[model samples]
Target: MIRRPVLLRAARPVALTLLVLFGTGTGTIDLWAQPVQKPLTKQAQTELDTIGAELRANARKREQKHQSARQIAEEMERLRTQMIDIARTQGASEKRAAIYRSRLETLTLLEADMTRRLGTLRNKQSRLLSALQIYSRNPPPTIFVSTRKANDAVIAAIILKEITPELKKRAAVLSEQNRDLIRVRREAALQNEALFISESDVSEQQKQLETLMADRAALEDQLLREADAIEARNLELEARQRTLLGLPSPLRAPQGRALDLQLPVVGEKAGSYGESIDGQTNRGLRLKTAPGAQVRSPGNGRVEYAGPLEGYGQVVILDVGGDYRIVMTGLGRVYVDPNRTVAKGEPLGRTPNLTDKPTIFYMELRKGENPVNPASGFDLTKL
Candidate 1:
């Protein structure tokens, strides 16, 4: 006997509850939704579509005939490869993470709001249902068709005309919310499974990735000394020039020229390069980042500068090869010290965990002595 998936097992009760809530199963219309913060690039969107398609394809596989042990092993290898590809590609991976984060955030806000609204709706529904049950004791009156007299028909028509539109609108909103909740819950379940995989019975592929992450996070004593020396030298050079523009490009250039980069952090675009603010022109893109969000290196690079400034919070600069440098600011903490070789997508630090408002993160990509439009510096993909 085949055991149905947990989702399948609980579907009926979920459906029934939703039906009772709205008097019809529902929620797809964004009745009271706020605008979502969209930061994905074209490539990132494409990558997401690909991932979703693949996940769906994988789901379809279960409906087919069961496989042998050999076939299962082969499938596992294929899945491992797929996971690695998704994880390493910062654009798709980070975008997905951002989507998940934002979605959960939005869902939280909506759920809170909906909890109150749903309670009211449920109360209204209860009254309506009670009246419905009482009326069911007799033949329930339809607008005009079921009325016994002309005056009764006119009264019923008048009442329905006043109530029908508002009731229908509320019903539609409830239906859409129900659907959205179901979808969100399903995704949350998948994340729980992802979390479980990390905790126990870890896969070899995941272990290898974890090892790399741990290694990147750990800095040796020697690396720390080198980073400090480099940071000091860069500061001295900047002082001599009396300028902070493109400070990392001239010194300690990386060997290989990276052809691409992911955004250093996920955020809503708060400011952009060349935009004038309070009479001063902005030199880099600024983002309103998620609270306590992990900042990642945009590309494979050496940490040229990672410390704090007077007004700005913690900062990190990366020499991302071929004299191309990335300067990031507004981190709450710097994870990588100076002079350490950091891989693309490696965790650099985190934004301040302030909840009142989002912390602003600033990033600039420069070559030689000038800041270039971030898009011109390299392929800037979504993170």
Candidate 2:
């Protein structure tokens, strides 16, 4: 009797049933005719499940490493900016510049190191891929076959031989499938190796970037520390110059020689000197006007500064004659250029949304370089 190829397909699962059938002959064959489901063993299923989980984890790790590399590149950019700033700011001082140079050198070395490590990993990855390709395409060794005579027993043997060829074909398919699996495993290994090397290099880059950042921070701190003392010294020098010029220590209200300082626009004069507005002393009267009010020159002067000055955004400093300088801050845009002369009451700029109510320009007076409150020179009582 001819046995179906399906019988061989179920060989492993039907091992126990086949053995009992072979022992009882005809009676057991009838029992074996009924279909019975048999699942893979727990250990075999667990092994397959583990491979899938491993593949998923490897993919996840690969993604994480790529993200880490991106982060490292960003941090490297930040460090490069800091390096540029340091080179520009501290390059004059040999000691400070040397510090910056050292940091730059360190970062450069780190970059080169990372490049070398990445190259090595890439080569390793390529080799692994090549090995995997060869393993996949090259087939496994085939099983040997035996050729003999045919008779009553030979009929049974021939039937077995015919089915055996089908078994060999099935096994070949399985062998190819296993080879494909091995290729996948090798590829995953290569990915893992690359990720490991890349991550290590990225880690080193992060450290170097952090170090450069700290150096930049130290340089900034040094600059800030010297800035206050320099500013104080400048103020002292201005004060001494004022004393030498025979100007009063503090110009008293309505005491200075009168100069025709033109008004910007007719707005309600609100406050005076030593008075408080917005929790700060009102150095000049707050003129309450509509939002985006035009401000004009107090007197003809040459524009000295026409940009942001500390605590005053978009300011203009004009050198009015007789050592007088008028500073108008909180401007939206400047209408005049530096060194450009203007007549009395010429438009300087406009103030927009200065305070909760309508905007007012923050005006101050500086004689030469000494900032004298505008109230000291103007007659505020008249307003």
Candidate 3:
């Protein structure tokens, strides 16, 4: 009898801790005091089986799309190589050269369109990957629910009666999250595969275009006799080549001082340069702000990098001319793509929504990979 009272006293603290964690009332203590087992009914089993089948089917569909994208990318690469080879061998025939040029022009446009599509897929994949990581770190408890009311009654008597309502709610939320994670994982895998294939396709096309340009330059020197005519034709070809290749003009320094530039995002500085986070010294300033807050470009520049980065959810690196580069990270979504130009104050991306944690945006200025204080260039009062 004395031992019984001692055990009850010891169990009280444990029960109370659980109640605090789960936010359950005193009435829930008795229900959750003992372990219980309940077998799922036939209808409930059938429903879960159906759900599993649907998930598999969706994964297969995504796989098919991935394969299709890969095939198309391969075909694009082959066509580009064929066009370049034809242009080099048949340059003497004006009709053949014209045909090859037209095909090349079409291919260039198609490549750009495909690149944009791939970028979208990459962004989606990044978001899904972030969610997956979060779920993996803090997994929810599992609880089985029955679909048939009669079976549910039996299950409830055996198990549900022994589980707190708060815990049941948590279990349900976790179950839904698991389903979402499965779907997102399959989709992200397909997107990544498609992106890899498209990148290879674009690289090959660019190489072929460069080769064709070189061939044209050589042929011009061999065929043309008049120096003046040859120079003029070469200049025209050079201009056409630059346009077709989408090469940027020579980099020039900005007119105003760097300090006059606007702030990238509207937020208070959380950490300054030289401050250590997780034992690593910060090379830039961390800005704390609301979730989904818009991140903007501090000055006119081109996007150099935009995608998922380790430790950072999504990152965007912008080239602002004169060897100056801006690095922004901890974004939820990116609005720009590499090689795309942006004006000052243009939207670059948004900070991720971390419900239980504060959203922080990290920004750094660099001159050839050497970190510099961004505050030296921006108005401190505004940020």
Using TM-score as the measure, the top candidate is 1
- Ranked candidates, highest lDDT first: 1, 3, 2
Candidate 1, residue 71: how far the Cα is off, in Å: 48
lDDT of 3: 0.57
**Sequence-dependent TM-score of model 3:** 0.33
Question: Which tens-of-lDDT digit does each residue in 246-297 have in candidate 3?
Answer: 3343234344456456777657778888889899999998888654456789
Best by lDDT: 1
The Cα local distance difference test for each model comes to 0.58, 0.53, 0.57
Where model 3 places Cα greater than 4 Å from the true spot, the runs are 1-259, 354-357
Per-residue lDDT tens digits for candidate 1, residues 1-383, read: 01222222122332322322343223322110212233344554454344334433433343221122223324444555666674566455445556666666665667667667777887896787577456446543555444356566567558757876887788888788777767766776675554444433335556665555445334222233343343344334324322211112223323333456777776767777899988999988888865545688888989988999787768898998788888888886688889999998888986664342567889888886678788665443332
* Candidate 3 displacement at residue 178 in angstroms: 52
**Cα deviation in Å at residue 68, candidate 2?**
52
Q: Which ten residues in a row are the worst by lDDT in model 3?
A: 1-10
Worst 10 residues of 1 by lDDT: 1-10
List, residue by residue over 1-383, the lDDT tens digit for candidate 2: 11112222223332534432343343323323433244335654354344334434444453343344334434545687766664454434444445545555554565556556545655665565566467447534334323432243356446656756765665565556555545545554554555455445444655676787666444433432243233334345435423332334543336564455755644556555558878987665556554334567888778988876777778888888888887777675566788889888787765542222455556677787766666544545434
CA-RMSD of model 1: 33.5
The alpha-carbon deviation from the true structure for residue 152 of candidate 3, after best TM-score superposition, in angstroms, is: 90
